[model samples]
Target: MDNHAITTRGLTRRFGAITAVDSVDLDIPRGGVVGIVGPNGAGKSTTIRMLLGLIEPTDGAGTVFGEPITRPKRYADRVGALIENPAFLPNISARANVQSMATLRGVPSDRVDDVLEIVGLSDRADDCVSKYSLGMKQRLGIAIALLPDPELLVLDEPTNGLDPAGIVEVRQLLRRLGDEGRTVVVSSHLLSEIEAAADYLVVIRFGKILFAGPLGDLLEQERRYVDLQPEMESEIEDLASVYTNAGYDVTIEPDTVRVVIDPVESANLNRLAIENGFVLRQLIRSNENLEDVFLRMTDANTEVAA
Candidate 1:
């Protein structure tokens, strides 16, 4: 087994003259969970398809478990994937559906029961697929994928369309699967879900790599700022000038002056306000959520340092 589960360089794909996935590079390591996240149509699915050897890349190459993706047979047996949407025979029982897939793959029917428990579908395994909720159906897809006992599991937007509880259910399952030492690659647009579930994060937008690194490292890249609200609204402009004149990036607001500065420099901001004879009623440093950080990065259209 390779230390890296998948790797690509200059990977590209085009739909006629329109490039869907630009020159993208990826190095996905084995074990734990890796998240390939971006806005809708940011080439997440295309990249996965290329890796799965489902679609040919216009340029570059890659490998899975050290086997060339061009030769899927070399490694196909070890990879299980639930891509796009999972459509099961609506009329049949979940157990029957899972059992049918298991039989097709030459996997013993006993494995179906094991997988049902793994996905928390044991209780509804005998119920018709038509009676299952969206979340339950998604789990059935995962159960089918697990029947083969794949070393690498690829799930594209497994939590898409799931409700709050369903999202939580899938999130916990991903964490459990990763802890078991399997390489799980999941792609989703929901930043919160990925933030809570993924160990490594790959951010992409407009068919390009914005960032790819450990989740903590990406969070660390979010800039810190101090928000100062003067007691007198009239003094807001003057207070903002104090930082601007000193060469700090400052944004004037209706009541507060937003200063982009290291949190440790918060004391300096207070001193500056006091020196400028501006009374501050409130001064707070706000922490940004993942959505805030990601939106800012993508809006700037700049590559984030890995």
Candidate 2:
């Protein structure tokens, strides 16, 4: 079997004149959570649909468990997906909804109970889906996906409509699934949630990959910004101008200054400040996370488009 649980090469999908998903490549390994993040209309959903074989790609090809995605039966039992907001039989109970999935997929009857428990829906398993809260319904959708006990789980906006408590619950569930040695892929527009839940991230913009790797490594690659806090407010502008005159991007806040500088520039600025007799009370280098990277990349794209 291929080591990668999911692999896509030049995946592209078009809707007549508009290209919903452009050429994209991704490889998700086993036993880890890979977060897919992008702005609205950035092809995150389109990519998920293509991966599930729900929509055929206009160009390129992909595989789930090394089997052609186009041939769903080849790896259908090994892949579980909550493509989007799932449709349920509102009149029936949550457990029944999952049982229906098991029936259609020829999954074992006992698996429904197991998945409901896994998603924390066992307490209200018998509750009619119509009466369940949005968060509960979301869990039911996941229960349906897990009925087959697939090795890979794909969740798109799993926290959508979830309350704060529900969000935490879902995050914990994803972490637990990863601990059990199952490959997980989560797609969301919320970078903060991704930062907390995902180990690695694949950030896409305008349907193209902007970055792909461990979250920590990506932040390390970007220039570090130093936040400086000083005692005197009146002298802050002068201190900022000192760096700005030296060609650094200096952003001054109420009580802090955000100085974006490369390593070489950082060294020079530090030396220059001391030489000029500026008392620097505090200075700390900041390594930005996935959220910062996402904002920078997406904002740059917007500027280019404008």
Global lDDT of each model?
0.87, 0.83
lDDT of 2 at 252: 87
Off by over 4 Å in 1: 230-245, 251-256, 270-282, 302-306
Query: lDDT tens digits, residues 1-306, model 1?
Result: 468999888899999987878899889888989998888988899999998999999998888999888998888778888888887999999999998988788888899999999998899899999999888889889888888898899999999778888889888988988999888999998677788988999998877888998999888887788899999888888888889999998988677899989878899999988888888899889766678788877766744522
TM-score winner among the candidates? 1
lDDT of 2 by residue, 1-306 (tens): 688887889999899998877788888777778888888788999998887878889999998888887887788788888877867999998888888888999988888889998888888999899998888888888888777777888998898889999999989988888788888899888888887878888888888877777877776766578877665767788888888887888888778777987544555666777877777777777766656778888887777767
Which residue ranges in model 2 land beyond 4 Å of their true spot? 227-258, 262-287
* Pairs of colliding residues, candidate 1: none
TM-score of each: 0.86, 0.84
Best by lDDT: 1
What lDDT does candidate 2 reach at residue 211? 77
